[model samples]
Target: MEAAIKFEAHEEVVSFDQEGNVVVNKESHMSKKLMARRAIEAHRERKRLESELEDYYFEEM
Candidate 1:
């Protein structure tokens, strides 16, 4: 299997390439889509953590 790495910008994947090689324009679409998905997932995780912290603080009060 080829190891893949992605570069993202502005919530878009600007590039995706196998390790040790450069990615070109053709790979940009999928890379951007993956980047967007990852970003959304990260946002959700942050929200969950904040909610948990709020609950914890309230319980301790």
Candidate 2:
């Protein structure tokens, strides 16, 4: 089974200069860390739920 929703990490604080170069912002660093932490928690929750479901099925059988 797969997650119903998939998260794709993208750069949102990028701006082009006169030379048309990608300039990343430093503020996005914190947000990226937060996003990574959230993703890990979500993964853990999914695994926990899956394990519980399997145990329930085994008990039913």
Candidate 3:
């Protein structure tokens, strides 16, 4: 027989992953959206940096 898990009325559900980090099972929609937005921002920053480097090289020639 397995023991039943319980939670307090006001407690939020929490779990852990393989790495032992605290994982929140809720707010999936918000988290996914935030992750995607961050990824796009990182990509844009990388491209801007690359463009600046290229311009610098061209100017020196």
The candidate that wins on TM-score is 1
Score candidate 2 by TM-score against the native.
Answer: 0.51
Q: Highest lDDT among the candidates is held by which one?
A: 2
lDDT of 1 at 28: 52
Q: Provide the clashing-pair count of each candidate structure.
A: 1, 0, 0
lDDT, candidate 2, at 23: 49
Model 3 gets an lDDT of 0.56
Candidate 1 per-residue C-alpha lDDT over 1-61 given as tens digits, one digit per residue, 9 for 90 to 100: 2233423333243333454233334445455676566656656666699799999999999
Q: What Cα-based lDDT does every candidate model obtain?
A: 0.55, 0.59, 0.56
Task: Give me the displacement of residue 16 in model 3, in angstroms.
Answer: 25
Question: What is the TM-score (0 to 1) of candidate 1?
Answer: 0.52
All candidates: TM-score: 0.52, 0.51, 0.51
lDDT ranking of the models = 2, 3, 1
How high a TM-score does candidate 3 get? 0.51
Question: Candidate 3 on 1-61: residue-level lDDT in tens?
Answer: 1232223322343444686444554643345665456556655666699799999999999
Estimate the lDDT of model 2: 0.59
Off by over 4 Å in 1: 1-30
Cα shift from native, residue 30, model 1 (Å): 6.7
